[model samples]
Target: MELEVRNLSVSRGGVPVLEGLSFRLAPGRALILRGPNGIGKTTLLRTVAGLQPPLSGEVGLDREAMAYAAHADGIKATLTVAENLSFWAQVFGTGDITPAIDGFALDELRNRPAGGLSAGQKRRLGLARLLVTGRPVWVLDEPTVSLDVDAVAMFGAAVRRHLATGGMALIATHIDLGLDEAEVMDVGPFKAKPPKVEDFDEVFL
Candidate 1:
Protein backbone atom coordinates (compact mmCIF):
# COMPACT_ATOMS: atom_id res chain seq x y z
CA MET A 1 0.00 0.00 0.00
CA GLU A 2 1.12 3.57 -0.61
CA LEU A 3 2.09 5.86 2.25
CA GLU A 4 -0.06 8.92 2.74
CA VAL A 5 0.56 11.85 5.06
CA ARG A 6 -2.43 14.18 5.44
CA ASN A 7 -2.06 17.75 6.60
CA LEU A 8 0.43 16.79 9.29
CA SER A 9 1.61 19.15 12.02
CA VAL A 10 4.57 18.10 14.13
CA SER A 11 6.32 19.55 17.16
CA ARG A 12 9.71 19.38 18.85
CA GLY A 13 10.16 19.90 22.57
CA GLY A 14 6.45 20.63 22.89
CA VAL A 15 6.65 23.55 20.44
CA PRO A 16 5.23 23.37 16.94
CA VAL A 17 7.73 23.41 14.06
CA LEU A 18 5.72 22.47 10.99
CA GLU A 19 2.01 22.43 10.15
CA GLY A 20 -0.35 21.76 7.27
CA LEU A 21 2.08 19.47 5.50
CA SER A 22 0.75 16.74 3.19
CA PHE A 23 2.41 14.25 0.93
CA ARG A 24 2.01 10.82 -0.62
CA LEU A 25 4.68 8.24 -1.41
CA ALA A 26 3.68 5.58 -3.87
CA PRO A 27 5.31 2.21 -4.19
CA GLY A 28 8.71 2.24 -5.93
CA ARG A 29 9.13 5.97 -5.26
CA ALA A 30 11.19 8.12 -2.91
CA LEU A 31 10.67 11.50 -1.31
CA ILE A 32 13.43 13.72 0.09
CA LEU A 33 12.83 16.34 2.75
CA ARG A 34 14.78 19.62 2.61
CA GLY A 35 15.11 22.49 5.05
CA PRO A 36 17.72 24.44 6.98
CA ASN A 37 19.08 23.05 10.22
CA GLY A 38 16.59 22.94 13.10
CA ILE A 39 13.67 23.16 10.69
CA GLY A 40 12.03 20.05 12.28
CA LYS A 41 12.90 17.61 9.54
CA THR A 42 13.89 15.12 12.18
CA THR A 43 10.77 15.86 14.15
CA LEU A 44 8.59 15.31 11.12
CA LEU A 45 10.30 12.01 10.29
CA ARG A 46 9.96 10.84 13.88
CA THR A 47 6.29 11.61 13.83
CA VAL A 48 5.76 9.72 10.60
CA ALA A 49 7.76 6.79 11.96
CA GLY A 50 5.47 6.58 15.00
CA LEU A 51 8.35 7.34 17.36
CA GLN A 52 6.38 10.39 18.43
CA PRO A 53 2.81 11.61 18.01
CA PRO A 54 2.00 14.35 15.56
CA LEU A 55 0.30 17.44 16.91
CA SER A 56 -2.36 17.02 14.21
CA GLY A 57 -3.15 15.11 11.01
CA GLU A 58 -2.31 11.52 10.24
CA VAL A 59 0.43 9.31 8.88
CA GLY A 60 -1.33 6.71 6.76
CA LEU A 61 1.11 3.90 7.34
CA ASP A 62 1.44 1.71 10.39
CA ARG A 63 4.66 1.17 12.34
CA GLU A 64 5.06 -2.34 10.97
CA ALA A 65 5.04 -1.03 7.41
CA MET A 66 7.91 1.39 7.95
CA ALA A 67 11.52 1.11 9.07
CA TYR A 68 13.29 4.05 10.67
CA ALA A 69 17.02 4.83 10.63
CA ALA A 70 18.24 7.86 12.49
CA HIS A 71 21.70 9.40 13.08
CA ALA A 72 22.70 6.88 15.73
CA ASP A 73 24.05 3.59 14.43
CA GLY A 74 21.65 1.66 16.68
CA ILE A 75 23.94 -1.34 16.73
CA LYS A 76 24.74 -3.49 19.71
CA ALA A 77 28.36 -2.65 20.45
CA THR A 78 29.03 -6.16 21.67
CA LEU A 79 27.63 -7.93 18.64
CA THR A 80 29.61 -8.89 15.58
CA VAL A 81 28.61 -7.56 12.18
CA ALA A 82 26.91 -10.78 11.15
CA GLU A 83 25.28 -11.14 14.52
CA ASN A 84 23.84 -7.65 14.36
CA LEU A 85 22.22 -8.29 11.02
CA SER A 86 20.97 -11.63 12.19
CA PHE A 87 19.38 -10.04 15.23
CA TRP A 88 17.44 -7.52 13.21
CA ALA A 89 16.52 -10.17 10.70
CA GLN A 90 14.99 -12.24 13.47
CA VAL A 91 13.21 -9.24 14.91
CA PHE A 92 11.62 -8.47 11.58
CA GLY A 93 11.06 -12.14 10.75
CA THR A 94 12.93 -11.74 7.47
CA GLY A 95 15.49 -14.48 7.34
CA ASP A 96 18.83 -14.24 5.54
CA ILE A 97 21.28 -11.45 6.27
CA THR A 98 23.26 -12.26 3.16
CA PRO A 99 21.76 -9.46 1.08
CA ALA A 100 22.34 -6.97 3.86
CA ILE A 101 25.93 -8.07 4.25
CA ASP A 102 26.56 -7.88 0.53
CA GLY A 103 24.56 -4.67 0.04
CA PHE A 104 26.79 -2.59 2.31
CA ALA A 105 30.01 -4.49 1.65
CA LEU A 106 30.00 -5.88 5.14
CA ASP A 107 31.25 -9.36 4.20
CA GLU A 108 34.86 -8.50 4.98
CA LEU A 109 33.89 -7.26 8.41
CA ARG A 110 31.20 -9.83 9.20
CA ASN A 111 33.14 -11.46 11.99
CA ARG A 112 34.35 -8.19 13.47
CA PRO A 113 32.73 -6.80 16.58
CA ALA A 114 30.68 -3.67 16.08
CA GLY A 115 32.63 -1.90 18.84
CA GLY A 116 35.91 -2.28 16.98
CA LEU A 117 34.68 -1.11 13.59
CA SER A 118 35.37 2.41 12.31
CA ALA A 119 32.62 5.03 12.29
CA GLY A 120 31.86 4.51 8.60
CA GLN A 121 31.75 0.77 9.00
CA LYS A 122 29.36 1.09 11.91
CA ARG A 123 27.13 3.36 9.87
CA ARG A 124 27.07 0.83 7.04
CA LEU A 125 26.08 -1.92 9.43
CA GLY A 126 23.29 0.25 10.81
CA LEU A 127 21.99 1.05 7.36
CA ALA A 128 22.09 -2.64 6.47
CA ARG A 129 19.45 -3.22 9.09
CA LEU A 130 16.97 -1.63 6.74
CA LEU A 131 17.27 -4.51 4.31
CA VAL A 132 16.44 -7.14 6.89
CA THR A 133 13.42 -5.15 7.99
CA GLY A 134 11.41 -6.18 4.91
CA ARG A 135 9.28 -3.13 5.45
CA PRO A 136 7.76 -1.19 2.60
CA VAL A 137 8.70 2.31 3.68
CA TRP A 138 12.07 3.51 4.98
CA VAL A 139 12.15 6.63 7.09
CA LEU A 140 15.76 7.76 7.27
CA ASP A 141 17.27 10.88 8.88
CA GLU A 142 20.76 11.76 7.64
CA PRO A 143 21.43 8.14 6.74
CA THR A 144 24.75 8.91 5.14
CA VAL A 145 26.21 10.81 8.07
CA SER A 146 29.45 8.88 8.49
CA LEU A 147 29.66 7.34 5.02
CA ASP A 148 32.52 8.06 2.62
CA VAL A 149 32.11 8.65 -1.11
CA ASP A 150 32.00 4.97 -2.03
CA ALA A 151 29.81 4.14 0.94
CA VAL A 152 27.43 6.89 -0.09
CA ALA A 153 27.16 5.37 -3.54
CA MET A 154 26.48 1.97 -2.00
CA PHE A 155 23.64 3.49 0.02
CA GLY A 156 22.22 5.19 -3.04
CA ALA A 157 22.21 1.88 -4.85
CA ALA A 158 20.54 0.09 -1.99
CA VAL A 159 17.79 2.71 -1.90
CA ARG A 160 17.28 2.28 -5.63
CA ARG A 161 16.96 -1.44 -5.21
CA HIS A 162 14.44 -0.96 -2.47
CA LEU A 163 12.35 1.30 -4.67
CA ALA A 164 12.61 -1.10 -7.57
CA THR A 165 11.04 -3.74 -5.35
CA GLY A 166 8.02 -1.49 -4.73
CA GLY A 167 9.32 -0.06 -1.47
CA MET A 168 9.22 3.66 -0.65
CA ALA A 169 11.67 5.94 1.13
CA LEU A 170 11.27 9.19 3.03
CA ILE A 171 14.69 10.66 3.60
CA ALA A 172 15.99 13.88 5.16
CA THR A 173 19.50 14.64 4.03
CA HIS A 174 21.51 17.49 2.47
CA ILE A 175 23.77 15.28 0.39
CA ASP A 176 22.96 14.44 -3.22
CA LEU A 177 22.16 10.71 -3.23
CA GLY A 178 22.12 10.58 -7.03
CA LEU A 179 18.54 9.33 -7.18
CA ASP A 180 17.30 11.32 -10.17
CA GLU A 181 13.73 10.05 -9.88
CA ALA A 182 13.24 11.10 -6.28
CA GLU A 183 10.98 14.07 -5.49
CA VAL A 184 12.07 16.84 -3.14
CA MET A 185 9.96 18.67 -0.55
CA ASP A 186 10.94 21.82 1.29
CA VAL A 187 9.50 22.28 4.81
CA GLY A 188 9.92 26.07 4.83
CA PRO A 189 6.35 26.83 3.80
CA PHE A 190 5.03 24.65 6.58
CA LYS A 191 7.01 26.29 9.38
CA ALA A 192 4.74 26.93 12.32
CA LYS A 193 4.18 30.51 13.44
CA PRO A 194 4.83 31.45 17.02
CA PRO A 195 1.79 31.56 19.27
CA LYS A 196 0.29 35.00 19.88
CA VAL A 197 0.77 36.58 23.31
CA GLU A 198 -2.95 36.53 23.89
CA ASP A 199 -3.06 32.77 23.22
CA PHE A 200 -0.61 32.21 26.07
CA ASP A 201 -2.55 34.55 28.36
CA GLU A 202 -5.71 32.63 27.58
CA VAL A 203 -4.15 29.54 29.15
CA PHE A 204 -4.13 31.14 32.58
CA LEU A 205 -7.33 33.18 32.25
Candidate 2:
Protein backbone atom coordinates (compact mmCIF):
# COMPACT_ATOMS: atom_id res chain seq x y z
CA MET A 1 0.00 0.00 0.00
CA GLU A 2 1.15 3.55 -0.70
CA LEU A 3 0.17 7.06 0.40
CA GLU A 4 0.86 9.89 -2.01
CA VAL A 5 0.60 13.64 -1.79
CA ARG A 6 1.18 16.01 -4.66
CA ASN A 7 1.79 19.74 -4.53
CA LEU A 8 0.12 19.85 -1.15
CA SER A 9 -0.57 23.29 0.24
CA VAL A 10 -2.45 24.41 3.32
CA SER A 11 -3.41 27.80 4.65
CA ARG A 12 -4.86 28.80 7.97
CA GLY A 13 -6.12 32.25 8.87
CA GLY A 14 -5.46 33.42 5.32
CA VAL A 15 -1.78 32.74 5.86
CA PRO A 16 -0.13 29.80 4.12
CA VAL A 17 1.40 27.24 6.43
CA LEU A 18 2.49 24.50 4.04
CA GLU A 19 3.01 24.98 0.37
CA GLY A 20 4.18 22.67 -2.39
CA LEU A 21 4.83 19.92 0.13
CA SER A 22 4.58 16.34 -0.98
CA PHE A 23 5.73 12.85 -0.02
CA ARG A 24 4.83 9.19 -0.37
CA LEU A 25 5.10 6.21 1.97
CA ALA A 26 4.71 2.50 1.44
CA PRO A 27 3.96 -0.47 3.66
CA GLY A 28 6.40 -1.77 6.28
CA ARG A 29 8.19 1.55 6.69
CA ALA A 30 7.81 4.17 9.37
CA LEU A 31 8.22 7.85 8.54
CA ILE A 32 9.17 10.23 11.31
CA LEU A 33 7.95 13.78 10.69
CA ARG A 34 10.30 15.97 12.69
CA GLY A 35 10.02 19.72 12.99
CA PRO A 36 10.11 22.51 15.49
CA ASN A 37 6.80 23.38 17.16
CA GLY A 38 4.10 24.72 14.82
CA ILE A 39 5.72 23.91 11.53
CA GLY A 40 2.53 22.37 10.25
CA LYS A 41 3.51 18.80 11.17
CA THR A 42 0.22 18.08 12.87
CA THR A 43 -1.56 20.02 10.16
CA LEU A 44 0.01 17.80 7.54
CA LEU A 45 -1.03 14.65 9.34
CA ARG A 46 -4.47 16.04 9.94
CA THR A 47 -4.86 16.73 6.27
CA VAL A 48 -3.83 13.22 5.40
CA ALA A 49 -6.32 11.85 7.89
CA GLY A 50 -9.13 13.98 6.42
CA LEU A 51 -9.51 15.78 9.72
CA GLN A 52 -8.94 19.08 7.93
CA PRO A 53 -9.14 20.22 4.35
CA PRO A 54 -5.94 21.27 2.65
CA LEU A 55 -5.95 24.55 0.78
CA SER A 56 -4.71 22.68 -2.25
CA GLY A 57 -3.35 19.16 -2.31
CA GLU A 58 -4.04 15.54 -2.89
CA VAL A 59 -3.91 12.96 -0.10
CA GLY A 60 -4.36 9.73 -1.97
CA LEU A 61 -4.58 6.98 0.54
CA ASP A 62 -6.12 3.56 0.29
CA ARG A 63 -8.81 4.97 2.64
CA GLU A 64 -9.39 1.62 4.29
CA ALA A 65 -5.65 1.42 4.86
CA MET A 66 -5.36 4.26 7.35
CA ALA A 67 -6.28 5.36 10.88
CA TYR A 68 -5.38 8.48 12.82
CA ALA A 69 -4.66 9.30 16.48
CA ALA A 70 -3.89 12.90 17.20
CA HIS A 71 -2.55 14.69 20.28
CA ALA A 72 -5.96 14.74 21.86
CA ASP A 73 -6.80 11.92 24.23
CA GLY A 74 -9.32 10.41 21.80
CA ILE A 75 -10.64 8.57 24.83
CA LYS A 76 -13.99 9.07 26.46
CA ALA A 77 -13.52 10.15 30.06
CA THR A 78 -16.64 8.47 31.38
CA LEU A 79 -15.97 5.09 29.78
CA THR A 80 -13.86 2.25 31.10
CA VAL A 81 -10.52 1.58 29.38
CA ALA A 82 -11.91 -1.58 27.82
CA GLU A 83 -15.01 0.26 26.73
CA ASN A 84 -12.94 2.75 24.76
CA LEU A 85 -11.16 0.05 22.80
CA SER A 86 -14.37 -1.84 22.27
CA PHE A 87 -15.97 1.29 20.92
CA TRP A 88 -13.17 1.90 18.41
CA ALA A 89 -12.99 -1.73 17.31
CA GLN A 90 -16.69 -1.88 16.72
CA VAL A 91 -16.62 1.39 14.85
CA PHE A 92 -13.87 0.08 12.59
CA GLY A 93 -15.65 -3.25 12.06
CA THR A 94 -12.87 -5.14 13.80
CA GLY A 95 -13.78 -8.34 15.63
CA ASP A 96 -13.02 -7.31 19.21
CA ILE A 97 -10.93 -5.03 21.40
CA THR A 98 -9.51 -7.80 23.59
CA PRO A 99 -6.46 -8.32 21.39
CA ALA A 100 -5.60 -4.62 21.42
CA ILE A 101 -6.19 -4.45 25.15
CA ASP A 102 -3.63 -7.22 25.49
CA GLY A 103 -1.26 -5.70 22.96
CA PHE A 104 -1.02 -2.38 24.79
CA ALA A 105 -0.56 -4.04 28.19
CA LEU A 106 -3.76 -2.45 29.35
CA ASP A 107 -5.29 -5.53 30.95
CA GLU A 108 -5.03 -4.14 34.46
CA LEU A 109 -6.73 -0.90 33.60
CA ARG A 110 -9.46 -2.53 31.55
CA ASN A 111 -11.99 -2.21 34.32
CA ARG A 112 -11.04 1.32 35.31
CA PRO A 113 -12.73 4.39 33.93
CA ALA A 114 -10.52 6.29 31.49
CA GLY A 115 -10.85 9.49 33.51
CA GLY A 116 -9.15 7.87 36.47
CA LEU A 117 -6.08 6.83 34.49
CA SER A 118 -2.78 8.65 34.30
CA ALA A 119 -1.49 10.48 31.22
CA GLY A 120 0.51 7.44 30.15
CA GLN A 121 -2.47 5.20 30.65
CA LYS A 122 -4.62 7.46 28.51
CA ARG A 123 -2.04 7.59 25.75
CA ARG A 124 -1.86 3.81 25.73
CA LEU A 125 -5.59 3.60 25.46
CA GLY A 126 -5.45 5.94 22.49
CA LEU A 127 -2.70 3.89 20.90
CA ALA A 128 -4.68 0.74 21.52
CA ARG A 129 -7.35 2.13 19.23
CA LEU A 130 -4.96 1.84 16.31
CA LEU A 131 -4.38 -1.88 16.81
CA VAL A 132 -8.04 -2.67 17.24
CA THR A 133 -8.95 -0.68 14.14
CA GLY A 134 -6.66 -2.88 12.05
CA ARG A 135 -5.74 -0.12 9.62
CA PRO A 136 -2.46 -0.15 7.73
CA VAL A 137 -1.43 3.53 7.72
CA TRP A 138 -1.20 5.08 11.15
CA VAL A 139 -1.20 8.87 11.26
CA LEU A 140 -0.10 9.63 14.77
CA ASP A 141 0.53 13.02 16.35
CA GLU A 142 2.86 12.80 19.34
CA PRO A 143 2.05 9.24 20.33
CA THR A 144 4.47 9.35 23.26
CA VAL A 145 3.89 12.80 24.67
CA SER A 146 3.22 11.92 28.29
CA LEU A 147 4.70 8.47 28.84
CA ASP A 148 7.40 7.61 31.34
CA VAL A 149 10.62 5.98 30.13
CA ASP A 150 9.24 2.45 30.24
CA ALA A 151 5.96 3.44 28.71
CA VAL A 152 7.83 5.22 25.94
CA ALA A 153 9.79 2.07 25.26
CA MET A 154 6.62 0.03 25.23
CA PHE A 155 5.05 2.41 22.74
CA GLY A 156 8.13 2.23 20.57
CA ALA A 157 8.11 -1.56 20.64
CA ALA A 158 4.47 -1.68 19.72
CA VAL A 159 5.09 0.62 16.76
CA ARG A 160 8.01 -1.55 15.69
CA ARG A 161 5.79 -4.59 15.80
CA HIS A 162 3.27 -2.81 13.64
CA LEU A 163 5.96 -2.04 11.08
CA ALA A 164 7.08 -5.64 11.11
CA THR A 165 3.53 -6.62 10.27
CA GLY A 166 3.57 -4.46 7.09
CA GLY A 167 1.89 -1.46 8.63
CA MET A 168 3.18 2.04 7.84
CA ALA A 169 3.05 5.03 10.15
CA LEU A 170 3.61 8.77 9.99
CA ILE A 171 4.45 10.08 13.43
CA ALA A 172 4.88 13.69 14.52
CA THR A 173 6.85 13.90 17.71
CA HIS A 174 9.81 15.51 19.49
CA ILE A 175 11.20 12.18 20.72
CA ASP A 176 13.05 9.45 18.89
CA LEU A 177 10.90 6.37 18.27
CA GLY A 178 13.88 4.00 18.53
CA LEU A 179 13.11 2.33 15.21
CA ASP A 180 16.24 1.28 13.30
CA GLU A 181 14.90 1.78 9.79
CA ALA A 182 12.87 4.87 10.49
CA GLU A 183 13.16 7.54 7.79
CA VAL A 184 13.41 11.01 9.28
CA MET A 185 11.77 13.86 7.44
CA ASP A 186 12.95 17.24 8.64
CA VAL A 187 10.07 19.64 8.70
CA GLY A 188 11.90 22.27 10.70
CA PRO A 189 12.99 24.54 7.88
CA PHE A 190 9.57 24.20 6.36
CA LYS A 191 7.83 25.87 9.24
CA ALA A 192 6.88 29.51 9.42
CA LYS A 193 9.95 31.00 11.14
CA PRO A 194 8.02 32.87 13.80
CA PRO A 195 4.73 31.91 15.38
CA LYS A 196 1.98 34.27 14.45
CA VAL A 197 -1.51 34.66 15.76
CA GLU A 198 -3.99 33.55 13.17
CA ASP A 199 -7.73 34.06 13.15
CA PHE A 200 -9.73 30.99 14.01
CA ASP A 201 -12.34 31.64 11.37
CA GLU A 202 -9.74 31.43 8.60
CA VAL A 203 -7.38 28.92 10.19
CA PHE A 204 -9.50 25.87 10.74
CA LEU A 205 -12.86 24.40 9.83
Candidate 3:
Protein backbone atom coordinates (compact mmCIF):
# COMPACT_ATOMS: atom_id res chain seq x y z
CA MET A 1 0.00 0.00 0.00
CA GLU A 2 1.08 3.60 -0.58
CA LEU A 3 0.08 6.97 0.84
CA GLU A 4 0.25 9.91 -1.50
CA VAL A 5 -0.26 13.58 -0.82
CA ARG A 6 -0.59 16.07 -3.65
CA ASN A 7 0.24 19.70 -2.90
CA LEU A 8 -1.53 19.45 0.44
CA SER A 9 -2.12 22.48 2.62
CA VAL A 10 -3.01 22.16 6.29
CA SER A 11 -4.14 24.66 8.86
CA ARG A 12 -5.06 25.18 12.49
CA GLY A 13 -7.76 27.58 13.68
CA GLY A 14 -8.40 28.51 10.05
CA VAL A 15 -4.84 29.78 9.75
CA PRO A 16 -2.67 27.87 7.35
CA VAL A 17 0.49 26.33 8.81
CA LEU A 18 1.84 24.14 6.01
CA GLU A 19 1.45 24.44 2.24
CA GLY A 20 2.50 22.73 -0.95
CA LEU A 21 3.39 19.52 0.86
CA SER A 22 3.52 16.32 -1.14
CA PHE A 23 5.06 12.90 -0.60
CA ARG A 24 4.44 9.22 -1.16
CA LEU A 25 5.33 6.38 1.24
CA ALA A 26 5.36 2.77 0.13
CA PRO A 27 4.78 -0.27 2.32
CA GLY A 28 7.59 -1.68 4.53
CA ARG A 29 9.02 1.78 5.01
CA ALA A 30 8.80 4.69 7.46
CA LEU A 31 8.90 8.44 6.87
CA ILE A 32 10.08 10.74 9.66
CA LEU A 33 8.86 14.34 9.84
CA ARG A 34 11.37 16.93 11.07
CA GLY A 35 11.03 20.65 11.83
CA PRO A 36 11.19 23.23 14.56
CA ASN A 37 8.33 23.78 16.98
CA GLY A 38 5.04 25.20 15.63
CA ILE A 39 6.06 24.27 12.10
CA GLY A 40 2.89 22.13 11.62
CA LYS A 41 4.22 18.60 12.00
CA THR A 42 1.27 17.61 14.19
CA THR A 43 -1.12 19.54 11.98
CA LEU A 44 0.11 17.65 8.93
CA LEU A 45 -0.23 14.30 10.67
CA ARG A 46 -3.70 15.18 11.99
CA THR A 47 -4.85 16.29 8.59
CA VAL A 48 -3.52 13.10 7.03
CA ALA A 49 -5.31 11.06 9.69
CA GLY A 50 -8.59 12.82 8.77
CA LEU A 51 -8.85 14.32 12.29
CA GLN A 52 -9.02 17.71 10.59
CA PRO A 53 -9.55 18.81 7.02
CA PRO A 54 -6.66 19.81 4.82
CA LEU A 55 -6.95 23.39 3.60
CA SER A 56 -6.28 22.15 0.03
CA GLY A 57 -5.06 19.23 -2.09
CA GLU A 58 -5.70 15.61 -1.31
CA VAL A 59 -4.60 12.59 0.77
CA GLY A 60 -4.74 9.44 -1.33
CA LEU A 61 -5.12 6.39 0.87
CA ASP A 62 -7.76 4.17 2.40
CA ARG A 63 -8.91 5.64 5.71
CA GLU A 64 -9.64 2.17 7.01
CA ALA A 65 -6.03 1.12 6.48
CA MET A 66 -4.55 3.86 8.70
CA ALA A 67 -4.22 3.93 12.49
CA TYR A 68 -3.54 7.27 14.14
CA ALA A 69 -1.86 7.80 17.52
CA ALA A 70 -2.16 11.28 18.89
CA HIS A 71 0.20 13.09 21.29
CA ALA A 72 -1.90 12.05 24.25
CA ASP A 73 -1.72 8.54 25.64
CA GLY A 74 -5.53 8.05 25.39
CA ILE A 75 -5.54 5.69 28.35
CA LYS A 76 -8.33 5.26 30.88
CA ALA A 77 -6.90 5.94 34.29
CA THR A 78 -9.30 3.70 36.20
CA LEU A 79 -8.75 0.59 34.15
CA THR A 80 -5.98 -1.97 34.52
CA VAL A 81 -3.24 -2.10 31.87
CA ALA A 82 -4.53 -5.29 30.31
CA GLU A 83 -8.09 -3.97 30.46
CA ASN A 84 -7.11 -0.89 28.49
CA LEU A 85 -5.51 -3.03 25.77
CA SER A 86 -8.54 -5.30 25.77
CA PHE A 87 -10.87 -2.35 25.24
CA TRP A 88 -8.92 -1.14 22.22
CA ALA A 89 -8.55 -4.66 20.85
CA GLN A 90 -12.31 -4.95 20.87
CA VAL A 91 -12.70 -1.57 19.22
CA PHE A 92 -10.33 -2.60 16.45
CA GLY A 93 -12.05 -6.02 16.19
CA THR A 94 -8.84 -7.86 17.12
CA GLY A 95 -8.97 -10.75 19.57
CA ASP A 96 -5.36 -11.46 20.43
CA ILE A 97 -3.42 -8.79 22.32
CA THR A 98 -0.52 -11.05 23.19
CA PRO A 99 1.82 -9.40 20.75
CA ALA A 100 1.10 -5.89 21.97
CA ILE A 101 1.65 -6.89 25.55
CA ASP A 102 4.87 -8.68 24.72
CA GLY A 103 6.07 -6.04 22.34
CA PHE A 104 6.07 -3.38 25.06
CA ALA A 105 7.19 -5.58 27.94
CA LEU A 106 3.93 -4.87 29.71
CA ASP A 107 3.37 -8.34 31.11
CA GLU A 108 4.39 -7.48 34.68
CA LEU A 109 2.17 -4.45 34.77
CA ARG A 110 -0.77 -6.08 33.05
CA ASN A 111 -2.89 -6.27 36.17
CA ARG A 112 -1.96 -2.86 37.54
CA PRO A 113 -4.35 0.06 37.26
CA ALA A 114 -3.40 2.52 34.56
CA GLY A 115 -3.60 5.32 37.09
CA GLY A 116 -0.67 3.88 39.00
CA LEU A 117 1.70 3.28 36.11
CA SER A 118 4.58 5.68 35.68
CA ALA A 119 4.63 8.15 32.81
CA GLY A 120 6.90 5.96 30.69
CA GLN A 121 4.77 2.90 31.33
CA LYS A 122 1.65 4.76 30.31
CA ARG A 123 3.36 5.86 27.13
CA ARG A 124 4.26 2.27 26.35
CA LEU A 125 0.67 1.23 26.96
CA GLY A 126 -0.56 3.93 24.62
CA LEU A 127 1.84 2.74 21.92
CA ALA A 128 0.89 -0.87 22.49
CA ARG A 129 -2.66 0.07 21.57
CA LEU A 130 -1.40 0.67 18.06
CA LEU A 131 -0.40 -2.96 17.59
CA VAL A 132 -3.90 -4.24 18.26
CA THR A 133 -5.41 -1.90 15.67
CA GLY A 134 -4.24 -4.22 12.88
CA ARG A 135 -4.02 -1.35 10.45
CA PRO A 136 -1.14 -1.20 7.98
CA VAL A 137 -0.45 2.52 8.07
CA TRP A 138 0.56 4.19 11.37
CA VAL A 139 0.51 7.96 11.77
CA LEU A 140 2.15 8.86 15.07
CA ASP A 141 2.81 12.17 16.84
CA GLU A 142 5.89 12.36 19.11
CA PRO A 143 5.47 8.68 19.99
CA THR A 144 8.59 8.57 22.15
CA VAL A 145 7.52 11.13 24.70
CA SER A 146 8.27 10.05 28.30
CA LEU A 147 9.76 6.76 27.16
CA ASP A 148 13.07 5.57 28.63
CA VAL A 149 15.92 4.20 26.52
CA ASP A 150 14.78 0.58 26.83
CA ALA A 151 11.21 1.52 26.05
CA VAL A 152 12.35 3.47 23.04
CA ALA A 153 14.27 0.44 21.84
CA MET A 154 11.18 -1.68 22.30
CA PHE A 155 9.18 0.82 20.29
CA GLY A 156 11.77 0.80 17.52
CA ALA A 157 11.69 -2.98 17.45
CA ALA A 158 7.92 -2.94 17.22
CA VAL A 159 8.03 -0.49 14.32
CA ARG A 160 10.63 -2.65 12.54
CA ARG A 161 8.37 -5.66 12.93
CA HIS A 162 5.46 -3.73 11.44
CA LEU A 163 7.55 -2.79 8.42
CA ALA A 164 8.81 -6.35 8.14
CA THR A 165 5.21 -7.39 7.73
CA GLY A 166 4.72 -4.88 4.86
CA GLY A 167 3.25 -2.08 6.95
CA MET A 168 4.37 1.56 6.84
CA ALA A 169 4.63 4.42 9.35
CA LEU A 170 4.70 8.21 9.25
CA ILE A 171 6.24 9.49 12.46
CA ALA A 172 6.77 12.99 13.89
CA THR A 173 9.45 13.02 16.55
CA HIS A 174 12.26 15.22 17.91
CA ILE A 175 14.68 12.47 18.93
CA ASP A 176 15.87 9.54 16.85
CA LEU A 177 14.14 6.20 17.32
CA GLY A 178 16.66 4.18 15.31
CA LEU A 179 14.54 3.58 12.19
CA ASP A 180 17.53 2.72 9.93
CA GLU A 181 15.83 2.85 6.53
CA ALA A 182 13.26 5.51 7.36
CA GLU A 183 13.26 8.55 5.11
CA VAL A 184 13.26 11.97 6.75
CA MET A 185 11.05 14.81 5.55
CA ASP A 186 11.94 18.25 6.81
CA VAL A 187 8.68 20.24 7.02
CA GLY A 188 10.56 23.55 7.27
CA PRO A 189 10.42 24.37 3.57
CA PHE A 190 6.72 23.62 3.45
CA LYS A 191 5.75 26.02 6.25
CA ALA A 192 3.09 28.42 5.09
CA LYS A 193 4.34 31.92 4.58
CA PRO A 194 2.83 34.70 6.66
CA PRO A 195 0.03 36.76 5.17
CA LYS A 196 0.90 40.08 3.51
CA VAL A 197 1.02 43.19 5.72
CA GLU A 198 -2.28 44.53 4.38
CA ASP A 199 -3.96 41.15 4.74
CA PHE A 200 -2.72 40.74 8.29
CA ASP A 201 -3.85 44.24 9.21
CA GLU A 202 -7.25 43.71 7.60
CA VAL A 203 -8.11 40.84 9.91
CA PHE A 204 -7.58 42.92 13.05
CA LEU A 205 -9.05 46.15 11.77
In model 2, pairs of residues that clash are 13-202, 13-203
Stretches off by above 4 angstroms in model 1 are: 199-205
- State, as a TM-score between 0 and 1, how close model 1 is to the true structure: 0.96
Q: C-alpha displacement of 97 in model 2, angstroms?
A: 1.4
Query: Residue-wise lDDT of candidate 3 within 82-143, one digit each (tens)?
Result: 99999999999997899999999999999999999999999999999999999999999999
Q: Rate the local accuracy (lDDT) of all candidates.
A: 0.95, 0.83, 0.94
lDDT of 2 by residue, 51-83 (tens): 777788788884567799988867889999988
lDDT, candidate 1, 71-111, per-residue tens: 99689989999999999999999989999999999999999
lDDT winner, 2 or 3: 3
Task: Select the stronger candidate by TM-score from 1 and 3.
Answer: 1
Stretches of model 2 off by over 4 angstroms after superposition: 192-205
Model 1: ten consecutive residues of lowest lDDT:
195-204
TM-score of every candidate relative to the true structure? 0.96, 0.89, 0.96
Best by lDDT: 1
